[model samples]
Target: MDLDSAFAALGDPVRRSLVARLAHGDATVGELAAPFDLTSQAISHHVGVLRRCGLVEQRREGTRRPCRLRTDQLALLSTWIDDQRRTWADRLDALEQHLTDEGADR
Candidate 1:
């Protein structure tokens, strides 16, 4: 999955809300749109963006298509965030130790 596309697709509040709803469980487009003021077409467009980014998937169930959050893709994003956090934490720790050592020498 393209991380940039995934992040970009979620940059919109509407799309983020849809994702949040799906986190509870899979939902039909109509169910997803019920909480929003946007039209069905608008909701579909948002879902399409998520689908293209592999963040959401639509599967057929007897002519009804429900959307599901792609947990694997979400995990990938979480891993990326965790990796960044660790990198920054390590750098900050090193900087703090350096300042302390300098203070001791003075």
Candidate 2:
């Protein structure tokens, strides 16, 4: 999955909500469209953005195409976030140690 594209696609609140909803279960365009005030076309556009980012996928089932979450992309994003968290935590710990050492010296 392209992290940049996924992040950009998720930057929109509507897209984020869509992602959150899909986390529960697969949904069709009509179901996804029902919650929002926007038209079905707008929902389709959002879904397209998600599809382009590899965050979600649509599958053909009879007459309907249900949208499912691509957990792999979400996993990648989670991993990236965890890495950032660890790096910052280590930096903060080092800064705290340095401050404590200085306080002891004074």
Candidate 3:
């Protein structure tokens, strides 16, 4: 997955909302648009952005193409966040220890 594209695509509030909704279950573009003030085409455009970013997938079922959240792609994003968290935590811990040691020497 292209993390940069995925991150950029999720930068939009509408796309984020669509992802959140899809988390519960898959829904057609029409179904996804019901709660929004935007037209179905607008919702479809958002979904297209998600699809391009690998955050969502659409499948044909009869007359409907339901969009589903790609959890594996989300997992990649989560993993990236966790890794950054760990790196920052380690840096802070090292700084704290350095301060503690300096204080002890004083």
> What lDDT does the true structure give each of the candidates?
0.95, 0.97, 0.97
Please report the TM-score between candidate 3 and the true structure: 0.96
- In model 1, residue pairs whose N, Cα or C atoms come closer than 3 Å (at least 3 residues apart or on different chains), thus clashing, are none
Our tally of clashes for model 1 stands at 0
Model 2 lDDT per residue over 42-89, tens place: 999999999999999999999999999999889999999999999999
Clash totals for all models, in order?
0, 0, 0
Error of 3 at 80 (Å): 0.7
lDDT of 1 by residue, 6-103 (tens): 99998999999999999999999999999899888899999999999999999999989999999899999999999999999999999999999999
What TM-score goes with each of the models?
0.96, 0.97, 0.96
